[model samples]
Target: MTLFRQIYSLLFSLFLLVVASLGYVQFTETQSFLTKQMESDLNNASTSLGLMLTPALEAGDTVAAETLVNVIFEGGYYNNIKLIWMVDGKQQEWNNPIKIDDVPQWFINLNLFKTIKKESTITSGWLQLAQLEITAHPGFGYHELWRIMSNTLIVFSLLFLVAIFTARLGLTWILKPLNALSEHAKKIAARQFGPDMPLPSTTELKDLVTAFNSMSAQLKHLFQSLDEEVGSLRKKNLTDPASGLPNRQYVVSRLNGWLSEPSSGALFLAKLDWLEEVHSKYGYQVRDETIRLLAEKLVQQLNEITPSVIARIAAFEFAFLVTDVEHDQISKYLQTLIRTINQEISKAGCKPNENFAIGVAERVGQMKVSDILAQADNALQKALKDNKTFHWFETTEQQIFTREQWRDNLSHAISNKKFKFRWQPIQFCNGDGVTQRELYCQLELGDKLTHAGQFMPYIELLSLGSLLDKCLIETVYEQKLLERNYEPLAINLTHQSLSDSQFHQWLNHFLRNAPQVERMCFEIPEAGVYSDLESCTRLCNIIRDNGAKFGIDHFGRQFGSMSYLQGLRPSYVKLDQSFAYYDEASHNSELCRAIINVAKGLDIQVIVTGIQEKAQLERFNELKTDAYQGFIAPPENIE
Candidate 1:
């Protein structure tokens, strides 16, 4: 029970005990007082009757004494009366009977008042003649006792109710601060620094609130400071000082990583033809200003076209790595870059001959980083020799599948639900057992099955992301039998899948009565969430309400703001492979620590993926990662 309820219960019990005890005491005292008063009245009536009868007997008026006795007996003050007369040494007695009326037997039995009788001697001239006896009825006493009890019960009941209502009001007023403190605690868990609560009249709770506010302020300041420091360090190391674009190392690393993956890629190199002439005519400072201005314009135009990495490789040469795009798209992006640079220089009143020369090389398969760089350089030399502003290197081999053919295959696969999944175990960092299975989807092409990397790009291009997600959900549901022996399943969703309203509606309906739904988890890429945050949050809320957990995969890659997590509150976040596998430099360490700390404050779990090295796992364990998913552990099959 809550503390408030406990307090109310205790107060109510104490009130009941006090009221009951007071009622009992008052009832007993009232009964005793009434009994004594009745006894006194009976004694006085008996004494007075005895005196009056003595006078009549002394005067030899027996008729008068008998008349007086009969009159007193018929008055009903006494239950019975007796008169004894002495004549010639023989005694004669008269006795009257009594009857009880109008009172219940139970009430009479409970009151149990005793009958009071008084005996008086009758004399003639100081000699006893007969004895006059009177007995009092107990009916009156029973009525008085019952009345006192009823009044006491009524009064005490009303008092008890009033006391409880007053106590409730007081307790609610006093505990208001405690309720605010509880809500404050929830906000802190969500990584929100809320306003301070009002101080309570209760001293102890006031002190607690003071301390809690102090701690919250400190944590908020710490997280902000870390964010600023990490951002500054990342920009300093990866960006060129003059042009504010990525450095040579950053671009090359990204190019190498993307080339190794199963995606089409292109490398574009552009050279400023009049850099030496500008430096000779003007000065080095003027040349530097021109290069910076040209680089800014080129980056602005490239970003408007598509997402690409821009870098300054040399004093006059710039490079870009555009992955997962067709050769035509790369050529268009290059043409836009050249046109934007020339327009910007013309606006600066520069000569028409002082322009940019660009070269492009496209890859469909795995190629060495050195080979890509050399091919792009050779193309640039050809462009300069041919007196052309742009040149392209074409491949000699024909592709295995045309664009239309791949689209047809993916569309058919999604429609027919011809997709298969392989389950891989994700283990806890503390050496505990596996927590869940990460699913990898595959498609069959004729006699052989094609992996996701080769076909997912096509599916994305066809706008079939939602359809693929639906297929995966159905596959997981079919694994109900396997779920009995293994952990739950975690599936990744594409941006299109999360943005589709119909998919969300279907998912909600599918899981309405589905057994073991809590054992399912849906994961979305951090970069994908930026596409439509409103839709993403709505989808996440739907999944969460249905007893499934939401997670962010490839986290910290976009280097975006984390304010979205406050609303999403995902169950866990998986670090990107690049962040987890790279060496722990000072900047990287600071960045990792900041991410973990922010997640911890939000009460969200952190998982580091791609920790293939034992040393890397140890380092992450020291960083308090909740789980790891990589080749360190062999993939365990679900069935």
Candidate 2:
């Protein structure tokens, strides 16, 4: 039992025992007093009657003696009265039998007071005349004793009830602080640091509450400090101090990540044609100010396009990447940016034509980082050579589908449930086999199987992500894929599904009926999580409520603060593949370690992805990740 219950039970038992003991003592004492009182009255009555009847006996008046005995018997106090006298050597006797009235049989059967008899010799002037005897009836004594004991019991019962109520209130008041402390500890466990608890009047509880509050505050401060430190490190290592844009290393990492996937985007490299002249004529401060102004203008121009990265790659050059835009639109946007840059620079005291020369390289299919950068650099040289403001180095485009064809293909595939599923094992770093298998799927279009990379962009463009996710979940359920293995099956969730309330309700119902729901883990991309955190958090709660798990994919890819993890608290995070390429001495490696540390502090599992070799695996071993996934344990087609 709980401490409160134990204490309350003990107090109640003690009160019951006290009440019982006092009641027994009171009943016994009342019985003894009545017994004594009855005996004394019997003796006194016998003595007085003997004196009063002596005259009658001496007068030889049997009638007078009988009258005296009858009067005593009729008084109803005595149970029995008798008169005996000798006249002319003959004996006469008078007797009365006992009688009892209102007392109950059960009380009389208790025999609290026993039968008593007393006798006294009758005499006239110191001579004995006759014998007078009287026996006391215990009826009056039993009645008096029962009355006193019943009143005592009633009073004690009332007191006992009052005591129980008083104890209950007192215990609740005393234990209220303990309950508050427990709730406060739970909040701390959830990484929520709220206001301190009010101290109780009980000294011990007050001290305990004070200690808990102090510990909570300290933990809150510790996490805040860690978040701040991580933010500072990101700013120092990945961001350019001069222009407040991402540094070259950050952009390269991002580009490398994109290149690994079947994704297409354009890379723009811009060179300030007058930066050298301005620095030579003016000072470092003026050059830096001009660069910052240009960066600000670029941000303002491209603010509408998300999933874009702008970086300061060199002393006089800047680069940026944009995806999901048509080539024609990209060209027009670049022309507008070039014109805007010249106009803004003229205001900063630079010649308009001598402003910025830009180069553009189109990334189609999987290409090396060196190839894209070299192509952009060659375009930059061509622009400088031709004295043009900007030049586009367009590469051969892949066979593309129109939006109508994509919508038709995706809708048919989703509705027909024609998706092929593949499973990839995420193994433990200690080589203890697989922790779980990540699910990857492809759409079957006729005889061809199209990977998610080729179709997902279209799905997002068509706003069919929620429908596709629901289709995939239904397929998994119908296939009973969870029963194929004991390990959990991790599935990826799209941002649209997270935001869709209808999808949430459907998933909730599906999981409620799923016997192996615990064998499932839903993963959301890092971008999706940060894009709409409220929706993601709500979805996470629903998944967890159904006993499934939630994870973050492409972790560490975002440059935003990691503080969100405190609230989201996913079961695990899959590090973005770029971290696998970073060497131990690289600043990205340090940032990776910081990420691992913060995740570990929250007890979240860290799994590094894209580990192609044992050396890459060993590189992450220093970072103390919980698991790894990639070519080391390549994905397998689930049969």
Q: What TM-score would each prediction reach against the true structure?
A: 0.81, 0.82
Task: Judging by lDDT against the true structure, name the best candidate.
Answer: 2
Quality of model 2 by C-alpha lDDT: 0.82
| Every candidate's lDDT | 0.76, 0.82
For 242-286, candidate 2 gives per-residue lDDT tens digits of 999999998888887777765556899999868777788798998
Q: What RMSD value applies to candidate 1?
A: 4.7
Please list the residue runs of candidate 1 whose C-alpha ends up more than 4 Å from where it truly belongs after superposition.
44-139, 198-208, 252-269, 272-300, 323-335, 348-411, 481-486, 501-513, 563-567, 584-603, 618-621, 634-639
Candidate 1 clashing pairs, residues 3+ apart or interchain? none
Clashing pairs in 2: none
Residue 189 in model 2: lDDT: 86
Candidate 1 to truth, TM = 0.81
Worst-scoring 10-residue span by lDDT in model 1? 90-99
Worst 10 residues of 2 by lDDT: 90-99
State the displacement of the C-alpha of residue 342, model 1, in Å, after optimal TM-score superposition.
Answer: 4.0
